[model samples]
Target: MEFEEVLNNLKLEKENNLAQECLNEIQNRQVLFHSGFEQEKKELTSLYRLRLKTAMDLNRDKFEEDVLANWKKTIDELESCSAKKLKLNWVRTEFKQFMIFWNSETKKLEGIFYLYPKNTIKDQEEYNTGIINGGLTVGSKKYNKGTFIKEWK
Candidate 1:
């Protein structure tokens, strides 16, 4: 079915708004692609693909507004094709910073909390204890460690 039709069917639920937002982002990205904004399009495409995993979270009613705002902010920044861009796959909170990615094998978006030590000695010491136990909490849900080790480390 067409994307619009899918949104139509979801009209009675909260998913409708989320689905519409996705469609709008998709359309915005496509317009950028056709306008010859290659770099911006590439970055936004990665985000768009990453966003597909949110549907499951939304259905479970565990989605967080802060994360959604984070995503929308990133999208707006990228869509503007501006030099001041937030780092991709990184989510920062007041207490911690997380690297997030979709784990293809598990079909889930996972986050890993990371702290960059102020000095080399501390960095080496902390590197030894990286990948903390109990996984990472994104929004209201906890996800297992992402399998993309190179990116996380």
Candidate 2:
């Protein structure tokens, strides 16, 4: 369903405080995910620059190997954590930082967009289609950004 519809339905469950809390927790997780994604982007950019400088000014093989090894260790940790479900309180306390670290390390290997491809046009199309199929919008006009025909009009 549309984000608005989803929120409306969620509000209806306000009578059940636990359900409301669960929804809040999920929303918080999404926020954490996005924040982590952005932080990772920055860290990857910095690491890329550092590695390039190190290779140019110092030892190429040694620098590259060290960075790669660090990256591999990060990937292993993320894989292990993802295999298990996290508790809500733990998620609240640690999710954003954990996600940032997870994202930063993953980006070091596969690139940032590899993890969250949502920024791509193809991904956007797929997501929009899913939203429509879920009865979230009546038509593309209701959700498509390009529907704004004005060029600063």
Best by lDDT: 2
Candidate 1 lDDT, 84-139, residue by residue in tens: 22222332222223332222233222222222223443343244345432353212
Q: How far does residue 45 in candidate 2 sit from its true spot (Å)? A: 48
Per-candidate TM equals 0.27, 0.19
lDDT, each prediction: 0.32, 0.34
lDDT of residue 4 for candidate 2: 36
Best model number under TM-score = 1
| Global Cα lDDT for candidate 1 | 0.32
Worst 10 residues of 2 by lDDT: 144-153
Q: After superposition, how far is residue 114 of candidate 2 from its true place, in Å?
A: 28
